[model samples]
Target: MMKNWLAAGAIALTAGMTTTVAQAQSTMIPGENVGLATGAPLPEGIYAINTFIYRSQDTAAADTAINIPILVWATPFVPFGGRIEFVVAPPTVFTFSRVAGGRDTSINVGTFVGGLWAFDLGGNVGVSFLFGSYLNELNAGRGGGLNILASNTYRAGAAISYTGDGYNLTANLTYQFYDTPGRFDGPNGIPAFFGPVGISDALNIDLTATKKFGKFEIGAVGYGTVNLDPNILVFPAGLGVAPGRLGRGGRFALGGLIGYDFGPFSVQAYVARDVVTTGPRGVESTDGFFRIVAPLYTPAAAPAPMPAPLVRKY
Candidate 1:
């Protein structure tokens, strides 16, 4: 039940506690795939997991909130001698700024869907690969002014893990490609200091090393993220505005996680800060995360113990 719980995928940026003028340039948010043995394969069953990833991006920049619910199913049949799992997650986004007495707004976002294939390579080592898309429905007339979530993103990634001796060492890598870098759901797109802006491609990697002792678990976790291309100003596709070189910047964070298993349910939590910052102001803030994984259904064991009764020799 403690095997590869969740893999890697890109969603959006963080809405920290402070207020600043920071618009997300990269699509992949760091620390989204921390804790858990995210690379290993789960046994054949159906499970539900809620992992909250908070970002303190750009220290007092405006803040956003998101609630994402995920459902996963490990299929009974294996393809190419590997386990195949399917996932679907849709998130509700809430954006609010702490200026002018705090303005609040809400909008419809995308649903994340992924198809992952995981394999166990003996020695309790597992590897998996996945492909997915974030189909964002950021239509107009929703409201105005918010650059917190990236729309129309495609993601691909891989994960590997070694779960042995009640310990887990795992890492997951996700690369996100954004189609509309300077686009949004509101009538106003990308609240820029000047004009519209865009971020090209980005990559994120999450690492975890943990050991379990009895019902308690402890681990160290971290993540590093970078934009693959230069940040630039954007315009409509039809409007031919040749993009120019802007700049490249990224961030790195480190933290720790602890968890406790009670019967068939487990909960984990962690907090991390941007230990290294190289981009916008207020990008140096702390993020705390919490997660819960529980089983919703399970396949019946084979052969059972004879549904009726066994005859005894009298």
Candidate 2:
């Protein structure tokens, strides 16, 4: 029963995690999947997960606003009785900066595709693992787009869930694989002498613990991101350092979540603010997030045969 209940939150975390934080772009957006069991295996069906997220800026200069439309298909080809899932996401990015009078431009950053394998470990516990890639992403400040990273990044993530007695506890994390020797993803890649102009490796962790009361659910959620490498801002060749870097930078935030399930669909929302910032606190904005998870296509129910006509002969 508990494992069945956790399915409501088995919402997988997709790539396209393009958002600005601590003055850097991350491979996976932090704190976007709070209060959900992102580690559990979803049932067989085509599903959609839409997320609206923003970083609040007082002046709206170089603010972060994103809308991600993620499509997931949980395939019926259960391997070893586990679920296999595939995902695709095409995200929209908005520029809300006031250079002269600010502009609201929606830019096509790129697309994200990945696959997942989830296993049910019995005892209301499940584990999900995934590997995905972010493709066609232009280098930051290049290709007339808003992306900050010039190198296409790859990510490996996992989610572990434990549900019991109407409780949902999950830990999810993603590690990014990338290197910015020179502007890599931009058209006509920039020379390495331009200096290392992008971010180094990093990791994101989101933790959730919540309990359901009938149809209402409430919990406390926390998220943190850390840069495994600890360089610093991009500098010119005079300094002999990369053009820029955000190594050794980390941020952590905590917030609350309240959501309700409407049988066929479910919704969850949460707000978290930076509690600890390790490196530079360039933009410490309070973040707001709203998410919707629902099945987009389900197998049609088998129809019952028409009863034999009146039996008039009898």
Error at 32, model 2, angstroms = 2.1
Off by over 4 Å in 1: 3-24, 137-150, 180-195, 234-246, 280-282, 304-314
Q: Whole-model Cα lDDT per candidate? A: 0.61, 0.68
TM-score for each predicted model, relative to the true structure: 0.79, 0.81
The 10 consecutive residues of candidate 2 with the worst lDDT sum are 184-193
lDDT of 2 at 104: 65
Decoy 1 TM-score against native = 0.79
> Per-candidate RMSD vs. true structure?
5.7, 5.7
Residue 245 of candidate 1: its Cα lDDT?
40
